[model samples]
Target: MAFRNGTDSWVVVMFFMIVVILFPLGVGPEPDILNKISSGVIWVAALLSAMLSMDRLFHVDYDDGSLELLVLHPQPLEFIVLAKVLAHWLTTGLPLIIVSPLLAIFLNMDISSYFVLIITLFLGTPTLSLIGSIGAALILGARRSGALLSLIILPLFIPVLIFGVSAVEASILGVSSKPQLLILGGLFLLSSALCPIASAASLRQAIE
Candidate 1:
């Protein structure tokens, strides 16, 4: 409803681009190094972008009192939480994925690695949205929720980061990125199943 008014979609896209722009300036414009680090940098920037926007996922609903209604509604809160997560990914992750190819080209990332880069994001960003739901829920009305949300969720994001970067690196090396891809897929599945339930429980506690 607030797509026109809300800045998150624009912010995330601009945030990802800004981060990508800064890396070469910070690291020097050496082609070899840029090419080598591009995948990792892209993944890192994308991760932080997702994290940056996560607070908006539930904080808005909580502030507006809609979250409590969903929590107390007849339908299970878990399912509602899942729907929110899905919507979050659709809005945030999808744009990031769509713009990533341009970032890859700008970073001098090899064309061969583009396939892996896109695949990893397709599998990994949704996992970010799923996992972030828990952190967002836990701090719905807490003091300094954004800072606390970062601390709580950054550690949890490491494995996804690892597998995601690894997949790109593997593809760059001309090796099969299948193993890392599979791990990310598994992590997404695990998070998709658990995070909504966990977030729902937290929301229920918060509302009660």
Candidate 2:
């Protein structure tokens, strides 16, 4: 289903690129300035990009009654929710990581920081998708869910963003980013354990 919606996937990637592109234009092309803010800018763009496609995470399933069927399935609904979240990350978060090196260049970030940036993103983006699944499920049938979903998830995303950018910045400063990366890893593990169950419960409620 995620692959079938190629346009939506591309939209997420485009939104991410545009956000990164705009920062260089708005902040001027000064390499030093761009370099300094690069980590934050890219991380923020990624967060927003992840948020962009979240509304549709289970909207289609809900509309077509697939959600009810999944909830009624013999297998656990949490596993089903986990699968959906995995699909969402593949179509959304993976693209951001793939294209981030080019954006880092646009922001004049150091080559040395690229690996750490990618590492942080690898650890952080899935957590975004995982945590986002809960919000997406919560707003399953709510009006103006896009806005409401953002409200529900944005605060939750802050910690991931903070740790992600901090890891990149630490790498750029020649400091070990291990601590931040470890924290990101922990966040990912925590979200992975919790979000699918929460999403499954919300989906059950929404379909009730």
Candidate 3:
């Protein structure tokens, strides 16, 4: 299903790149200034990019009635929600990670921080998807659900964003990023364990 919506994925990737590109243009082309803000800029763009496609996570299935079938399946709805979240991460989050190196270069991020940026993104983006899933499910059938989904999920995304940027910033400053990375990992595990179940419950409520 995600593959079928390839255009959305492309739009997200383009948006991520464009946002990063805009910072250089808007903030002036000074490499020093860009370097200072690179981690935050990239992370913010990734967060918004992730949110861009979030509404589609379950909306298509819900609209087409596949969500109802999946909910009614003998298999646990949580597993179904988890699978969809994984697909969402693959389509949306994975692209951000893949394209981030070039964006990092564009932002004048230090070479040493590149690895930490990738690591943080890898750890953080799935958590974004998982947590976003709950909001996506909650906003099902809602009018202007895209805005509502943003409102519901943006606060939840802040922790991931903070730690993700902090990890990269630490590396740039020649400090250890392990603490932030560990926290990001913990967030991923926590969201992985909890978000699916929460999303599944919301999905049930939505369908009713």
Candidate 4:
């Protein structure tokens, strides 16, 4: 559904591009300053872009009654939620990953850090989707849900945000980014194992 709609993904991509554009203006034209902050800026923007779309994960389904039917079906809701998160990542995160090199160039990111940026995002963004699913599911039909959703999910994203930026920073410094990358991979695995179950439970509660 996210892929078919196209608008959500486009918004995320545009937001990321806009962030990249704005930072350069605010920080001046120096390659040194741009390069210095590139990874952190991009990672933060990516995280926010994902958050901006998080509420849509289950909102439409909930509004249209598809969510009720989905809950009552025999298939495990956790698996269904996992599939949804995967689709969300494909529609949203993958585009960000694909276009990030261009953004990196705009930010004057070091050539060496490119690999780690892609690596960290590959390991990190699906976890973003997974984690966002739980937050979205938790707040289904709640008042002012966007604001509440961020409150629930943003803090949860901190560990991921930290390690993601750290991995690219390590690469820029000519140090091994492997440790941070491994932690990100581990975070993905952990989220994969846990978030879907939590989302499923939240959905069940919301529908009941």
* TM-score, per-candidate, Cα-based: 0.96, 0.98, 0.98, 0.98
Better of 1 and 4 by TM-score: 4
The TM-score measured for candidate 2 stands at 0.98
What C-alpha lDDT do the candidate models reach, one value each?
0.89, 0.92, 0.92, 0.92
Better candidate number, 1 or 2, judged by TM-score: 2
RMSD of each: 1.3, 0.9, 0.9, 0.9
Q: Write the per-residue lDDT of candidate 2 for residues 33-121, one digit (tens) a residue.
A: 99999999999999999999998899988898877888899999899888888999999999999999889888888888988999999
Residue-wise C-alpha lDDT for candidate 1, range 59-160, written one tens digit per residue: 777888887778778999888888888888888889999999888888898887998999999999999999999999898779998899999999999999
Please estimate how well model 3 matches the true structure, expressed as its whole-model Cα lDDT: 0.92
**What's model 1's TM-score?**
0.96
- Show the lowest summed lDDT stretch of 10 residues, model 4: 1-10
Native RMSD of candidate 1 (Å): 1.3
Pairs with steric clashes in candidate 2: none
lDDT tens digits, residue span 76-119, model 4: 99988988898899989999999999999999987789888999
Candidate 1 pairs with clashing backbones:
none
